[model samples]
Target chain A: MKRFIGFIRKEFYHIFRDRRSLFILFGMPIAQILLFGFAITNEINNVNIAILDHSKDTSTLEIINKISNSKYFSIKQIISREAEIESVFQKGKIKAVLNFEKDFGRNLIKKKSAQIQIITDATDPNTANSITNYINAILQNYLQEKNKSIQLDYQIIPQTRMVYNQELKSVFLFVPGVMTIILMLVSAMMTSISITREKELGTMEILLVSPLKPFQVIIGKVVPYIFLSIINAAVIVLLSIFIFKMPVEGSLILLGAESVLFIITSLALGILISTISDTQQSAMMISLMGLMLPVILLSGFIFPISSMPAPLQVISNIIPAKWFIIIIKGIMLKGVGLAFVWKETLILIGMTVFFIAVSVKKYKIRLD
Target chain B: MKNENVIEVENLTKAFGAFKAVNAISFEVKKGEIFGFLGANGAGKTTAIKMLIGISHPTSGKAKVVDFDVYTQPEAIKRNIGYMSQRFALYDDLTVQENINFFGGIYGLSRKAIRQKSKDSLVELGMHEISSKLVGSLPLGWKQKLSFSVALLHEPKIVFLDEPTGGVDPITRRQFWEMIYKAADQGTTIFVTTHYMDEAEYCDRVSIMVEGKIEALDTPKNLKQQFKVASMNEVFLKLARNIE
Candidate 1:
C-alpha cells in the first residue's frame, strides 16, 4: 500500500508538472459548459421577423403589437409590398414574414375568421419551425383576450407542460453531458496516454521487473486519475448549481458515489486501451475516435435516442455514457433515489467489470 | 545454499507460431560473475534475455532465475532482479533526486535508505551539485550512469542490463563497466547484453547468439583461439557469415 501511494504521488507529479495537460484538464470543462449554455440553445429568443400588413386596421395593429410584446420575435422590417417580403428574407436576418389579408377586421366580423399568411424560410428548418410556433402562440393569446366577453360553441385548446425542466434552461441538459465528457476525457484519455507513455519510454519494463506487482502498478497509475476525476466532477456540479441554477433533487451522496463508480469504469477503459496500444499517439487517437463520438452522439446528449433508427438505438445501449447521462438526469432533475437508477448503475458496473477482465487478460498475455 | 548459482537454464526455447526466436539456449551464471550475452541485431539475444528475466515464457524446457522457477515463480524472480533497458528509463521530467527516490520507493526501500542512496550515488558520480536539477538537463552519458546506479538501488542479487551503453562514448562505457565490476565485487551478479564485441572481452564468460541459437560459448580468449581469429569481432563475423 505504501508503495502504491508513492507511485500515485509520482503520477500526480507527472500530471501537475505538464502545463498543456493541466490546461486541458481544468480549462476545457468550464469553457464547454459556458459555450453550450449560452451559445448553443434550443429556446428561440429575439428572432428577427418582417410583416406585410395590407389592412391598417385595429385588429392587424393589435396582432402586430402582441407579436412584438412577446419575447420571441423582434420586428426587423415592415414591408408595404409582397415583393419586399422575399427580399427581406433573402437578406437572411428575417426568419419569418407575416402578411394579413386586405380588410382583415371586416372579414373577421362577417365571416367570423380571417386568413393571416405565415411564411417561414425553410432553409433552416428548426429555427423556422420555432418562429412559426411562437407566432401561433402570440395569436392564440390575443384571441383569448379578445374573446373574454363571448363564449364560442366550438373550440379546441391544447395543454402542454415541460416536466423535468419547466423553464427549459439548456444548462440543465448540458450539465450532465458536460460532466460525462469531462470525466471520460480526463479519466480515460489521460490515464491511457500516461500508461502508453511509460511503455514508449521503456519505463514499463523497468517497473515490471521491480518488486511491485503488476496489479499494484496498474492501480497506482489509475488511483490518481480517480481522485482527479472526482475533483473534476465536483467542479462541474458546483458550476451547474451556482451559475446555471440547476438543482440536485436527489441525494447528493448517491450522486457522488455513482459519479465515482463511473470514473472507475472510465479508468478501466483507459487501462484496456493502454494494453492494446503501444504508443501514446495511438492511445489518444483510440480514445478520441472510439469513445468521444459515441458519448456525444449516441448518448442522447443532444438528440433523443428513441427517435433514432433502430440500429443506432441498439448500438447506444452498449455505450456507458448513455447510462450515465440517464443516471445523472434522474438524480439532478427528477430527484430520484437509488431504486430509480439501479438499472443504469448495474450497466455501468457490468461495463467496468468487462473492461477490467479484458485488460487483466491482455496484461497477463504480455507478461507471458 | 550460499554457493548456489544465481541463474540456471536448460534447453530453454521460445517460439512464435512456426518461427523459433530463441532455439534451445542453455547457460548459467554463478553468484558473482560478469556474464556477457553478445550478438548482432536480430540474433535472438534479446529474446533469450527476456525469457531469463521472466517477462517472456519459453515454449519448451525449463529455467530458474535467482533460484525461482520462470514459469511459476516469476514474481519472486522479479523481486530478486533489477533491469535497465537499451533506452534510458529515468523519467526526464523528474529531478535527479526524485527519480532515485521514486525507483527506490517502488523497490520497497525505506525513505532513509532512498535519501542515503541518492546522496551517495550523486557524490560518487561527482554530480552532487546538480542533484536537484531535472534529468533532461543532464548529458546522455550522465543519464546512462545514473540509470545503472538506480537499477542497483535495491541491492538485487542479479542486475540485467540490455545494451546498457548503446550510444554513449567509450570513456563513459568504461566508467559504466567499472561500476559493474564494483557491483560484482560486492557479490551482485551482472548479466549484460551488448553489441560491442570489445565489451565481450571484459566479461568473465561470454556467449554469442546467431540466428536464434548460441554459436559460441566460452571466454573471449578461447573463442579467438578456437575460431582462429585475431579478435572477438572477427569471430562474430565469421559465425554470422556461416549462418547466412
Candidate 2:
C-alpha cells in the first residue's frame, strides 16, 4: 500500500508538471461546456424573410401583420412581383419567403380555406425545416384567435408537449453529451498516454524489473486519473445545473456512483490500450481514433441511436458510453431512481468488469 | 548456505521461432566481480541480460539469479536485483530527491531509510546542491550517474547496467567506472553491457558475443594475447570478421 501511494504521488507530479495535460484535464471541460452552452445552438431567432402579398386584401394584410409581430420572423423586404422572389433568394441573404395567393380573404370567406405558400431555402435543411414549422404554427394560431367568438361545427385539436426539456434548449441535450465526451477523453486518453509514457521514457522497464506487482503498477497509475475524472464529472454536472439551469431530478448519490463506475470503465479501456501500444504516440492515436470517435458518433450523444441504421444500432449496444448517456439523461431529465436505471447500471458494471478482467490478463509480466 | 557464484546458467537459450536470439551458451559470475557483456548489434547480449534480470524468460534453459530460480522464483529474484536499462532510466520531470525516494519505495524500503539513502546518494554524487533540480534539466552525464546511484539505493545483491555509459564523454565514463569499482570493492556484483571495447578492458573478465553465440570469454589480457591482437578493439574486430 505504501508503494502504491508513493507511485500515485509520482503520477500526480507527472500530470501537474506537464502543461499540455493540465490544460486538457481542466481547461477543456469548462471551455467545452461554455462553448456548447452559449454557442452551437439549434434554436432560431429573428430569421430574415421576405413577403410577397399579391391579394392586397384586408385578411392578407392582417395575416402579414401577425407574422411580422412574432419574435421568430423579421420582415426584411416586401416584394410585389412573383418574378422577384427567385432573385431575392438567389442573393442568399433571406432564409425564407412568404407568399399570399390572389384573393386569399375572398377564398377564406367563400370556401373556408385559403392558400399561403411558404418557400424556404433548403441550403440549410434544419433551418429551413424550422422556418416552415414556425410559420405553420403561426397561421394555425391566427385562425384560432380569429374564430374565438364563432363556434365551428366540428374541430380536431392535436396537443403536443415537450416533456423533459420544455423550452427545447439545445444546450440541455449537449450538456449530457459533452459530459460523456470529456469524461471518456480525460479518463481513457490521459491514463493510456501516461502508462505509455513510462514505456517510452524507459521508466516502465525499470518498473517491470522491480518488486512491484503488475496489478500494483497498473492500479497505481490509474488511481490519480480516477480521482481526476470524478472531479471532471462533478465539474460538468455542477456547470450544467448552475449555469445552464439543467436539473438533476434523481438521487444525486446514485448519479455520483454511476459516474464513478463509468470512469473506471474508461480507465480499464486505457490500461487495455497501453498494453497493446508500445509508445505514447500510438497510445494517443488509439485512444482518440478507437475511443473518442465511437463515443461521439455512435453513443447517441449528438445523434439518436433509434434513428440510426440497424447495423450501427447493434454496434452502439456494445459501447459503454451509450448506456451511460442513457442512465444520466434519465437521472437528470426524467427524475428516475435506481429501479428505472438498474438495467443500464448492470450493463455498465458488466462492461467494467469485462474490461478490467481482459486488460489484467493482457498485462505483460516480461518484456516480450 | 551461500554460494560463491551469484549467477548460474546451463544451456540457456532464447529463440524467436526458427532463429535463436541467444544460442545455447552458459557462464558464471563470481559474487563480487565485474562481468562485461560485449556484442555487436543484434548479437543477443541484451536478451541474455534481460533473462538474468528476471524480465525475460529463456526459451529452454536452467538459470539461477542470486540463488533464485529464473522460472519459479522470479519474484524473489526481482526483489534482490537492480536494473538500469540502455535508455536513460530516471524520471526526467522528477527532482533528484523524489526519484531516489520513489525507487527506494518500490523496493520496499522504510520511509526513514529512504530519506537516509536519498541524502547519502545525493552527497556521494556531489549533487547535494542540485537535489531539488529536475533530472531532465541536468546534463546527460549527471543523469547517467544519478540513474546508477538510484539503481543501487535498495542495496540489491547484483546490479545490471545495460549500456550505462553509451554517449557519455570519456572523462565522465571514467568517473562512472570509478563509481562501479568502488561499489564492487564494497561487495556489490556488477554486470554491465557496453559497446566501447576500452570499457570492456576495464572489466575483471569479458565475454564477446557474435551472432547469438559467445565466441570468447576470458580476462581482457588473456583474450588479447590469445587472439594475437594489440588491443581489445582489434580482438573484437578479428572475432567479428571470422564469424562472417
Candidate DockQ values, in order, are 0.82, 0.80
| CA lDDT, candidate 1, residue A204 | 94
How does candidate 1 score on lDDT? Answer: 0.89
lDDT of 2 at B18: 100
Candidate 2 matches the true fold with a TM-score of: 0.94
Residue-by-residue lDDT tens digits, candidate 2, B52-95: 88788889989999999998888999999889999998999999
lDDT, candidate 2, A8-105, per-residue tens = 99999999999999999999999999999997876678999999988989888888888899887999999999899999999998999999999998
Fraction of true contacts retained by every candidate, in order, equals 0.78, 0.85
Off by over 4 Å in 1: A55-59, A101-115, A122-126, A140-149, A152-166, B1-4
Among all windows of 10 consecutive residues in model 2 chain A, the one with the lowest summed lDDT is A153-162
lDDT of each: 0.89, 0.89
Distance from true location, Cα of A333 in model 2, Å: 1.4
Instruction: Say which docking band candidate 2 falls in.
Output: medium
Check candidate 2 and list the clashing pairs: none
TM-score of A-chain in each prediction?
0.90, 0.90
RMSD values, in order shown: 2.4, 2.5
